[model samples]
Target: MAVITHDSAVRRQLRSGLICAVVSATSFGLSGPLARGLMNAGWSSASVVAVRVLVAAAVLVPIAAAQLRGDWNLLRRNASLITAYGLVAVSGTQLAYFNAVAHMEVGVALLIEYTAPIAVVGWLWLRHSQRPTVTTVVGAALGITGLILVIDLRSGLTTSWVGIAWALAAMIGAAAYFVLSAHGDGSLPGTVLAAGGLLTGGLVLLAAGAIGIVPLHATTNPVVFQDFTIAWWPPVLVLGTVTAALAYVSGIAATRLLGSRLASFTALLEVLAALTFAWTLLGEAPRPIQLLGGALILIGVIVVRRGELATPDAPDRA
Candidate 1:
């Protein structure tokens, strides 16, 4: 009876983790279109990111404080990890991605950035000697191939060297996100980590702007979404609260439950979700080939899952 109960508990945890991962992906997928609207209204990418991080921090810090209660030393203890998470995962990732988009088609840039999972696998192999099983290698290959198809990179693939560099940087940042989120054994609550990370990221962006490293222009003009123009704050609010706040918190929680490798693989769903959002919210219809590509990504994720199950003793670390 105890064994059966233990199995049931594990199943429940898996189910909840999967749900959180999907929710995180969905929320994150919304950022592209919503930010695009703001950009169209004359907000610079740096400004958009800064506001998103700042607003998210503002909302989450109080909650984190409440969660921490009197145990404030968690922040001091995990300072370095939180800083890396903020600078690399949150701030650097967004900045590099937007910079890449400026120089290349969004689809192409996104495809390059989403190659982070493969980078994650490679990083684990090189740094921690956590060699992937054959199934993992095959699944990574299929996932990358499917991503290429899903983005439909047959045309408009032209990009400058600088754009490629930025995309690669974004990929590194993304890999760091998953690896750091998964490896931390500290006692900090996920909410605290998310909040602290956002605050630090926001400050970094602000400092960068102050130093004239990136242009930080912003506008209060109404944003056009699908059929009509609406108040800019509405979309920005959603971007901060839902996309950044909820997405980061839930993503960390999912990573904690699912482990880094599986969680990163599962995050491939963000591309499909982004495509779907583009179709519904921005009226960009997906090609049938893209639909097939999405299926292949799902298959690749399943393959990776099976591989991990087959190698249960393998530690998940990078």
Candidate 2:
């Protein structure tokens, strides 16, 4: 009976984690369309990112404080980890991606950034001496192929070397996010880590803006979505609360439960969600090939998940 209960609990946890991961991916997908609305209203990428992180930090800090119960030592001890999470995973990834998009098409930049899962696999193989199973390798190949098809990169090959470099940097940052999020030993709540990371990342963006490293233009004008214009605060509010705050926290939780390898692969769903959002919200319909690509991505995710589950106790070294 006890063994059965334990198995049941594990299944429940897996289900919950999968749900959280899906929610995180969906929420994250909203950022592109929402930010596009704000950009149309005269907001620079830096300004959008700065406000998104700041507002997310504001909303999450209180929840983190409550979860911590005044235990500040965890924060002190993990300061470096938190800083890396903020600077690399949050701020660096966003900055590099935006810079890449500035020099290349958004699809091209996103395709490079989403290759992060493959980078994570390579890092694990090299640094941790973990040899990926054949299943993992196959899944990764399928995922990358799907991503290429989904992004339809044939039209965007005019990308500059500088843009490619920035996109590669973003991929590294994204891989760092999954690895770091999965490494925590539960000494700190995911909420606290996410909140601290957001605060630190927000500060970094603000400082960069002040130093004129990035343009920080912003406007209070309303955002136009499809045929209607809404108050500026609406999109910003959703971007902060839903996309940044909820997405980061839930992503951390999913990574904790699913491990870096599986979690990162699962995150590929964000691309599909983004395409759907673009179609529904921005009137940008997806091509049939893109829909087929989405199916391939789903199959890749399932393959990776099965591989991970089959080797749940696999050691770093064969």
Candidate 3:
């Protein structure tokens, strides 16, 4: 075996970290579209999420075990936070987004879920006494405005209350993930937390399905499948492996490297990416309003990035 140099090791770590971040974003961005596709094929939101989480847990468990080998003690100490992170953060986000797309369009659900960054900033300000700069405030405003424009909230309110509610729920779940994950000590690698969290969330979903909290039978059963929406194994595998497992793993890596603020801000890119994917895959042409909303969202991200760079404390999520 060749001996590793310090610089070589550092470079390798950096490269690995960057790849993780990109993969995480890509996985997350694809989730909305895939869920929408699956649902259209006759699957229910509960079934889709339950299967995705269960599969993700299976893939992530071994990897997390490797990371937590000597660190089992940390898992017990942070059990509450870890469980909450998985349940609220991982499961909540997935279920909510899936439900939202079941009613509204994928782009609309994403526009709402992407609002988590601002919520995170607000939480830091109110709870931890972190002050927001002018740029941060503007970014928040812009993001909200863009979201409203993209989803045409006023029209949607009259159209479908369930869809709107599901999207908002997704935002809450996404925000929980951001806050809880950031608060954890850097000692626990995100991969381990993600594994534990996905496992917990999957269990919760499974239990909920068994007890009839969610109609998993309807979604998972073949009767739900139709001509337009077949239970294709390829898409399901992609959803479980890359989107769930790789996405969470990479997102945490980005958080570790770019800092939660920058990482979260960069994550907003998913909205645009999702829109692009929908357009290409499903041939869903966006309206003019969507175009404008997408532009504003991009601008808001730029403003947030600028403020994050200016505020030293913002980068230090812990």
In the range 1-318, model 1's lDDT, one tens digit per residue, is 997997688667667877889899989888878888899999988998899989999999999999988786878988888898999999898888878877888777888888888888888778877778899878877877888889887755686889999999999999999988876664788989899999999999989889987789988898987887899899999999998999999999988887677778889988888888888778889899999999998888888776655545445544
- Report the lDDT of model 3 for residue 274: 69
Task: In model 3, state the lDDT of residue 281.
Answer: 64
Q: Over 4 Å off in model 2, which ranges?
A: 1-9, 314-318
Looking at model 2, the pairs that clash are none
TM-score pick, better of 2 and 3: 2
**Model 3 spans > 4 angstroms off:** 1-22, 94-113, 152-156, 159-169, 218-231, 314-318
Model 3 C-alpha lDDT per residue in residues 210-237, reported as the tens digit of each score = 8876778434422222234445565677
The prediction achieving the highest TM-score against the true structure is 2
Clashes of 1: 0
Give per-residue lDDT, candidate 3, residue 240.
Answer: 86
The lDDT for every candidate, in the order shown, is 0.85, 0.87, 0.72
| Per-residue lDDT value at 281 in model 1 | 71
Q: Write the per-residue lDDT of candidate 2 for residues 222-267, one digit (tens) a residue.
A: 8888767899998999999999999999999998887778889999
TM-score of each: 0.92, 0.94, 0.80
Name the weakest run of 10 consecutive residues (lDDT summed) in model 3. 218-227
* Best by the lDDT measure: 2
